[model samples]
Target: MKQWLVFPRQKVGLVCVGKPVRCSGQESCSNWRAISRTQILLHSFLLFTFLLSPIAAGAVDITQQLHRSLNSSVGRQSRDEADSLLSIGEQQYASGYADKTIASCLRALELYHSIDDLKAEGLTYNLLAKAYVQLGSLKEVEDSLRRGLAIARDTQDFQAQIFVLNNIGTFFLQQGESAAASKTVEDALAIAHGVKNIEGEGLSLSNLGLVAARLGDYNKAIKLYENALIFRRQTGDAIAEANTLNNLGDAYLASGNYQDTIATYGTAMQIAKTNRDRTNELRAIDGLVKAHSAVGRYERTFDLLEQPLTLAKELQNLREELKSFESYAQLYKQQGNYLTARNFYERAIILARTLEDSKQEVQLLDQLTKMLQLK
Candidate 1:
């Protein structure tokens, strides 16, 4: 028997034959999601067969063998393989491998959509948005979140809806849309409470705090972060816990609570070190520098700036590296060293351009022009 996959919108299709069917050509179509009644039964049988292995052997190898069995044709990998790849993507995201997370999530998304796993497909799109934001890929982030949020809304998956909404709110915050961000996170918080999802509740609370902080309501922001911290710590999610603490520190700094800012950022930095969370470590260091420098602790600020700069370079995080340079420029400007500050500003602008971060580049250029005028 032969399996000829005919995609109606295109001039070409793929061919597969025999047991453990191998596809003959590349495929990039969504029609595979239209499963017939018989095909569903066949897929269930294939999925069941893949789950059996009494080998008492290596964990991942068994999973690999199962993937081989179920991948009978193009766009037809089993849910298990897609799940495994998605798990890897999640780990890459937590460990700050933004580029790798994008690649893995893209692969998992394709497999999930082919299998009609709309929930996982939606989740993957949100995951890709998170990765894109880290790399400053603004357009990609917008597109991914748009797709993910639509899927979640259409499916009425409360958990997926909360995830997508929270992410969309965070994206809005980045774009300086404080009102939109607030409303979006409020929607997520309502869903989280209605669904009794603690993790989602925590995330929504944290995002709302970000909105409040951006709007200069430090008191409200801190209160939201504190509540979010309670839930996040209860769940033992170090990544999220550190994120909330970092944001809390920013609120403290903005409100002139320097002592609290130092303490909050110190704890975040400690957690980041223990978890090898390079991204959060950089952020924590940035907060710590601001707090110390605001209090005229230049001695500590110098070493603080150097550490994140080195770490950012090592991680190939162009955005953070440029930020480090910008921070150096700000510090020198504060000390009335215009020439040194101008040099650091130029360096940051070059890195920002390399990152294709027009927003950051333009901001840096403006600051540079203003600083030059001061002398």
Candidate 2:
């Protein structure tokens, strides 16, 4: 449920259940031509590692209607048995068992389809979309979402429509189709407003903020995030609040408003800590370190980075770890410490290669080459 913004260069995205990653430089990021179609699938789906770690903020919960639909299906089969699989599939998805979720959902899908329960079948497709994303299967993701949307509309299930629309918007954002993303999210927003579903409102607003940010319209992004925050704060969901703040902090940083960036990131860190969300805590710390570094607070910058480096390694978030190395390289390069900077860049390149992020490896190498050239 991460809000995401895909750009041409410096590819800002997030990896947690939150937003998109942002690279350190403004170099062009045209991966489409060089990478295969399978790689393109990763483009829109892999934002969790680098964007701004918030899983899908305000994840759409199973509504009562959806529940009944799930429980009501399965002709000639044991009704209780099918319900159990559907329930287990939801549990598997929540537990991050991607393969299990897919298995459970596929089985459940057959039962629902056999019963001709469009609402239930549509919900199953939506469930499959979640599992497919983790597998980096964009083709499956698109197919699931399209089927879900069609079912939602055919059955006139307004709630299901809102859910499918919001998801479709996020998918478009990953595809780097901001215009389509915007339109799709706006449709969700309208439906949410009509239904008075505040969580939907917040999710749609936050996603629109991502679209705006991708378009380099920080002011608009900030406004949308603020509105989203208002709705989130009312929901008593601290994690969602922290995610929005992290995203808003990034927007502030992008706009050169360092003080606001610092404040926003600080708040995000606090909320993440209270929730014991180490991944998001790392994201907040990264934002703080970047803001501090940009304003020449070298001592504070290093201070801010140290713990997060350890935390990132602990989390096995290679991209976040690489980001810290890149930050170290940048800071040392600025201080005329070329040898130290080169060492950090080398480490980062290795990590990027391990992650199979060729673009990131190339970016790190470019930074290394530029630094050596200066020397």
Best by lDDT: 2
Residues 1-375, candidate 1: write the lDDT tens digits.
000000111111111112111111222112111110111000000000001111111123223422333445644546767878877876676544668889998898778767776666765776686666555555565567656655655666677667666665655554545666677679879998998888778878887887787688999999999999998887777867877788788889999999999999999999978987665677788889989999999999999999988987786656567777988999999999999999999999998677555666788899999999999
**Candidate 2, residues 1-375: lDDT per residue as tens digits?**
343323222111211111112211122123111111222435332434322111224434343334343343345354445556767876665444557878988887777666666666776676787767755566676567666655665566676667677776776666666776688789889998999978778878988898898799999999999999999898887877887898899899999999999999999999988887665687789889889989999999989889778876775656568878988899899999999999999999998777666667777898899889998
The root-mean-square deviation over C-alpha atoms between each candidate and the true structure, in angstroms, is 13.9, 9.6
Candidate no. 2 TM-score: 0.68
Q: Model 2 shows how many backbone clashes?
A: 27
Model 1 residue 32 lDDT score: 17
Worst lDDT 10-window in candidate 2: 15-24
Residue 262 lDDT (model 2):
98
Assess the local accuracy of residue 231 in candidate 2 as a C-alpha lDDT between 0 and 100. Answer: 92
What's the TM-score of each model vs. the native?
A: 0.70, 0.68
